[model samples]
Target: MTESDHRAKLFGTDGIRGIANMEPMTVETCVRLGRSAAHVFKDGTHRHRILIGKDTRLSGYMLENALVAGICSMGVDVLLVGPLPTPGIAYVTRSLRADAGIVISASHNSYQDNGIKFFSRDGFKLGDDTEHEIEQLTFTGRIDDIRPTASEVGKATRIDDAGARYIEHVKRSFPNGMTLEGMKIVVDCAHGAAYKVGPWVFKELGAQTINIGVEPNGRNINVGVGSLHPEVAA
Candidate 1:
């Protein structure tokens, strides 16, 4: 499908997302979520690390930084994979042997919408207990107890080239000789994380590609395009 032909999906049960800096997905809420996550993960462990990844939402840069700040205040290190698919973070968390993995994205949502999801050390979503604990921390403002020392403060580092690696992995799922050379495809990335690589993959496979929803303004995501709103795709 051409990028312009895609539609956006809506918010599911797991997280809150909407136009960037608006409604449920504002930067303020993201900061709070970060703090909440830090509190939930703090277990008196002197050493802690969190692996964070995001899709192409324009708001991703803001949210990722806010989340890292929140996590670091509680003394957890953050490793950032600038732009990656949701599943890629899950795999990297297990591979890198980190304490946790966080994804800042609204999968298939438009560029305006964004969200946060976490995975534990075991490579699964955070359990109810952990999520509840974080929620309580967010509401109660009782984070002082979990604060880290100056020396223990966490740092943020970016892992570039993550998208390339992810693309290679995704291509492996197809048949060895399958190619889309003669196909005409339209792709709508919702101007989010998949903006670059999504189209790249189709072109590499030799498809004649048309792209839309690939430009994010931090406010147009999921507004009129993406997987949720299939009208565009149709």
Candidate 2:
């Protein structure tokens, strides 16, 4: 049986997830996923792009580079927003008008786990049908023959301002005249995606924030801190 046949489903409700560096999350699978997604999102001769964002998982570095290699190999430019929230990636994807967005995260799961999710140009998570298409393409090898060379190959660019942009975007959601000047908030980032933004957003809005779980050593994410352990901040 093929990889797909052996595994009943490659993508769960939240995308492909597993122990980091293991079967589904392995670099080889990530490359295949990148190539398949690139093929599915291609839209004519116009240069296409995909935005990638991730949380503070050490495995993220390994997976991110693999995805970039695969996507770029298939001629899709990549916009990397290093270490941002999942939603921030979606917003940045639309903010930059990329063809699609990808998030490398496993939400509240422990650091040992990781996941991959996609978003459309509109900044919405991809639907089941589109995800299914990408999955099928990944295992079927139908996209292997379609490769771009020279200038046609895709390039990867880093979006240095992605965090600032997301900060501004989220700040807009608060009441126009509202400020957290008198509010004392305890912000526990769980050392995940929101580590930097969580405290900064509140502090900038004038809140006195007592921050815990802000120091992400990559492997410490969601370990005895963050949302999983609210008492840490409480």
Q: Estimate each model's TM-score.
A: 0.75, 0.97
Model 1 agreement with the true structure over 40-120: per-residue lDDT tens digits: 676664677889998766678888888888888777788888766677788777767778888888776555567778889
Evaluate all candidate structures by whole-model CA lDDT and list the values in order: 0.73, 0.91
Clashing residue pairs in all predictions, respectively, total: 26, 1
lDDT of 2 by residue, 56-150 (tens): 99999999999999999999999999999988999999999999999999999998999999999999988988998898888886888998899
Winning model by TM-score: 2
